[model samples]
Target chain A: MNQTSQPKLWLAQQANRFAPALFFIGLVLLWELICRVGKVPNYILPSPSAIITAFFNVEFSRWMIHLWATLRVALMGFVLSIMIAIPLSIGMMRSQLMNRILYPALIVIQSTPVVAVAPLIIVLLGTDDPSRVLITCLITFFPLVVSTTTGMLETPPEMIELSQSLRAPRYRETWQIRIPYAIPHIFSGLRVSITLAIIGAVVAEFVAAEEGLGYFIQFSTSFFKIPQAFAGLIFLSVISLLLFKSVQWIQAWFFPWSLPKKK
Target chain B: MDQAKNSAYVSMKGVGHQYAPQAPLVVKDIDLDIHRHEFVAVVGPSGCGKSTLLRMVSGLLIPSQGEVSVFNRPVTEPRDDVGIVFQKANLLPWLTVRKNVLFPLKHKYGSYSAADEKRANELLEMAGLTQFADKMPDELSGGMQQRVGIIRALLLNPDILLMDEPFSALDALTREQIGFDLLKIWREHPKTVLFITHSISEAVLLSDRILVMSKRPGTVLDLIEVDLPRPRSSKTINSPRFAELTDLIRGYIYEPDVPA
Candidate 1:
């Protein structure tokens, strides 16, 4: 009975490993079939083949330029937000007064639409990477602050007691104990904020940038080249996914203990 | 000899704690003297302020209406010579076993010396955790992790070891084994241990004296001296006296709930 079940178990494991890729391919194939058979217009919804063709229609250098533009703004904004959010969260964690003061201000900022503020920021900081980066920072920093604060606060009371018993200084306690404890939550926030960074950059580009995937999409749509716009949209998602995965990979590589344990 | 005995290494005088000005007291009118190298266990039902008593001794909690003094000095804040092992292992998962043990030195002083590292390794070796020194806390078993927590408490060579239910999280077999392990360690390197526990048999097995506390607004009910001969093990638990002591504590803590 053991021998019989072994091969069946191996097969199940193999199937489980390949199922996602298989399902994804099936979805694309079905979409392609539906598009072709239904005589779908390219302007309304471009076929997969047309999208791929349009992706390669432009010179590779031109695509690279736009990709670089969007990627730079997104990453710069992400790094900037991290710089601001972490220390802010630490400040908020260390002082009750700061938490009470900052919470309302943060909520106000979060509630106000970034879209409404983007043009004003573009006008204030000018239509450049700095303005675009600030816009992205505005969008991405809130979750980091909230998640980081929650994580730091969520540190076990016993661990806090351990720190207290050691007679460690408040700064050392926050740095060594609270910050390390908050890494998992901070990473979750980073994963969210990194993707939002991309969206924020695109939103900024929609309002002002001369070059970016968002701009390229807008440019293509204006020219009635829907397939080209679809290609640009694909680039946005692919970059967002890669950024998200990199955050997970960074956690796994540098702080593997933060990841949930496997059975 | 009487003066030395009276001048307790650690003393709490009429200690009481109320979390808020209007709130009811958690533990009140408590008085205890833990002599140098004595293993004193405080056993009570859950929320009987057994842990509150330890916190006061460690200087983590300032008693609202009394004083905790160590070696004739009042404890106003966290004392340097008091090491605490909490209920859970509470090992920092990010650090390896060796690093976790060395954490207190680094935590208190931002950096640990080579000598500190050497001391940490020695403590780990003594605890029989030398082989797993580089392994993460997550990689260790619950029993091993708790052992690491104990070793961490011992790392600083503190005069007082404040253990709040250190072995309660472990399974019965592992808890028993660790109890023996703790006895072996205490014999080698003595510290004034104030252990808080909910288990009466545990209190009987490990302590030189047990402080039984009544339920909340917890007050001291009795302090029983365990005259069981030293070098105690599972055999000690099987002895006739151990049973009597446990029965005595059980009666104090738990009235027979069943209709009798």
Candidate 2:
């Protein structure tokens, strides 16, 4: 009975491994059918095949340029957000008064719709990459601060006791115990912030931009370049997925101690 | 008076601790003096502030009144010479057993060198964890992780070790194994130890004297000396004397009116 059961279990495991790829192929086939049968207007909804064809046929350099623009904004905003959040989190953890004072302000900032702030920031800061970066930074910064502070503050009492009994210096305790303890949470916040940063950059570009995926989308839609617009949308999604996945990968690689970093 | 006449390695005089001003005391009017190299266990029924007393000794908590002194000096803050282990091994999951043992030393002294590696390995060997040195905390069993934690404490070569119900989390068999390992380490290193546990058998097996406490606001009820010989084993638990001491301590723990 055990011998037969082992082979059955192996088959079940193999089935699990093949499920996702099969589902994705099935999805593509269904999409192709909907485009063929429904005869949806190309201007409103481009066919999957046409979008894929345009994606590869388009001048590679032109796409690279757009990719560079979005990547630059995303990376810049992510780095800026991290710089602002880490120190703020440390401050909040160090003093309860700081948490009491600044945490509410942070909630207010986070709750404010990024779209509402986008035009205002464009108006105040002027139409440039700085405004886009600043908007991305604003969208991404608060959550990281909140999560990092929560993580640092949530260090287990036993770990803290261990450090205290060791007579560890204040800074060493923070760096070795608190910071490392907070890495999983911080990475989770950063993952969300990274995707948000990309969205923020695009939205900021929607208000005022001569380049970037948002501008490309706008230009394609106005010109009735429907396939190209869908292709641009596809590119934007890939950028987001890549950014999110890369952070997830980093989390897995470095902070394997935690439950797979929160998506 | 004869006990007091012995050299006091660690002393707590009338120590009282309260969580809040309006709240009741957690531990109160506790006076204790441990001789040099003494293995003392503080035992009481649950919530009797046995753990709180060890916390005071470990410098993790400040008493609301009175003093805690180690080696004749008042403990103002956590002393580098004091080592503590909690019921939870509470090891950093990110670190291997070796790294966690080296964790305290790295902060005390800057940088990890060949000397640190040697010390970590030596500690691991002492804890019977040399084979598991490279394993992460999560990878180890509960008993193994606690062993790593004990090694972490010994890595610093502290003058005294404070353990609060450190074996309480493990199963009976593992707990018994660790009890023997603890005595072996204590015999080799010869540090003043203040071990806290709610278990009567554990106290009987491990301590030179067991300080039993009343319920909160907890105060020391009695300090019973275990005249049992050195390096006691799990088998010695069957001995008539061991049974007698166990009953003596167990009597203090149970409420007479409660259903047995």
Best by TM-score: 1
Question: How well is each residue in B1-260 modelled by candidate 1, as lDDT tens digits?
Answer: 67765569999899999999999999999998888889999988788898888999988899999899999899999988888998889999889999999999999888989999999999988989999999998888999999999999988888899999998889999999999999899999989999998888888999999999998989999999999999998899889999899989888878566210
**A1-263 in candidate 1: lDDT tens per residue?**
69989999999999899999989989888878989999999999888999999999988999999999999999999999999999999999999999999999999999999999999999999998999999999999999999999999999999899998888899988989899999999999999999999999999999998999999999999999999999999978999999999999999999999999899
User: Model 1 TM-score?
Assistant: 0.96
Alpha-carbon TM-score of each model against the true structure: 0.96, 0.93
Instruction: Kindly list the per-residue Cα lDDT of model 2 for residues A1-263, writing each as its tens digit.
Output: 69979988999999899999889888988887888899987777778898998788778899888888878987899899999999999988888899899988988898999899999999998998898999999999987997898898899988888777767678888998999999989988998999998898888878898888888888888899999989999899988999999998988887788765344
Q: Report the C-alpha lDDT of model 2 over B42-139, residue by residue, as the tens digit.
A: 88778878887888887778888899998788888888888888788889987888898898878676568888799889889888888998888888
* Stretches > 4 Å off in candidate 2: A1-15, A259-263, B1-5, B255-260
Question: Which pairs of residues clash in candidate 1, taking residues 3 or more apart in a chain or in different chains?
Answer: none
What's the distance in Å from true for residue B260, model 2?
A: 11
Score residue B136 of candidate 2 by CA lDDT: 82
